[model samples]
Target: MRFYGFFRSSSSYRCRIAFNLKGIRPEFVPINLRRNEHRDAAFLAKNPQGLLPALEVDGAVLTQSLAIIEWLDETQPGLRLLPEDATKRAQVRAFAQIIACEIHPLQNLRVLNFVKENYDQDRNGADDWARHWIAEGLTACEAIAARHVRNGTFTFGDQPGLADICLIPQMFSADRFGLDTALYPRLREIRAACEALPAFADAHPARQPDVQ
Candidate 1:
């Protein structure tokens, strides 16, 4: 198996956590997004979308971080990222989408670059855009986890499953934009619990092989 991704990418960061949790280390192929390696012809051929965290396995390529992670959970052994219970699984998926779909895209590098280039926004302005969306989305997440989450150290339950996988990377991005964690105590606590685990800690952006 070969994993092509960039270190600072939240999507790639997610797969690293899943890989670590499953105790599987594929050949790590670093596609440095800062250098526009993801735009290169070779990488684009693998994923036409030109995104990070594309996985090559069993003579086929898989794109999208969430799909790849869920595929691994279904095919591989060791850890399960999604819960088995139907209702709980749906809740977890919803929570994951709140970050992956709603929050992440608004502040993605491509989006930020577009706004800055076409909308006359400066770097600081682009960052402000990111912060606004991240804060708005996380506030909703806080309501669910703080008011309704079950008795557990991590999100969804005691084990760090799909929600935590999604949350941790978004939390990292939140810190980048200077989003205060203190305001979301439940999220802050969950993040602390996740980082305490070797699986999550080892997958941190600062610890990645491609980190520059």
Candidate 2:
């Protein structure tokens, strides 16, 4: 398996966490988003969407971080990212979606670039846009996790799962934007617990090979 990703991409970070948890080490291929390598013809042939975190396994390429994660959960039987019980799985999925769907899309590189180009927003303006959406989404995420989190260590259960995989990267991004984590105690607590794990620590942006 070969993983194509950018070091600081939240979507790529999420997949890296899942890979560590599953104990699968794919060949790491850095796609330099800053240099527009993700848009190269070769990369577009693999995933026309031109997104980072595309995984090639057995001659098949998988795109979309969430889809790739769910594929991993299904194909790899050892560690389950999603719960077996239908209701619990739904709850976990919902928590993960709050970050993946509601928050991340607005703050991703393409969106930020779009705002900067069309609206004449500077770096500070782009960051403010990211923070606004992230804070709103995280507030709702905290509420949902508070209701459903079974253990203090993770978003869904005592062990890390899909929700934790999603939450930790979002927290990292939140910190990057100078968002005060104190605003969400439960989210911060869960993030702290995740940071203590080798899997999460190993997947951190600073630890990536592509970091300068």
Among all windows of 10 consecutive residues in model 2, the one with the lowest summed lDDT is 144-153
Give the local distance difference test score of model 2.
Answer: 0.92
lDDT of 1 by residue, 25-123 (tens): 999999999999989999988888887889999879999899999999999999789999899899999999999999998999989999999999999
Identify the leading candidate in terms of TM-score: 1
RMSD of each: 1.0, 1.2
TM-score of each: 0.97, 0.96
Q: After superposition, how far is residue 30 of candidate 1 from its true place, in Å?
A: 0.2
What is the C-alpha lDDT profile of model 2 across 1-212, one tens digit per residue?
Answer: 99999889999999999999999999999999999998999999988988778999998999999999999999985689999999989988988999999999999888999999999999999999999999999999989878765655688878899999999999999999988888898888888889999999999999999996
Leading candidate by lDDT: 1
Residue pairs clashing, model 2: none
Model 1 TM: 0.97
Q: Give the clashing pairs for model 1.
A: none
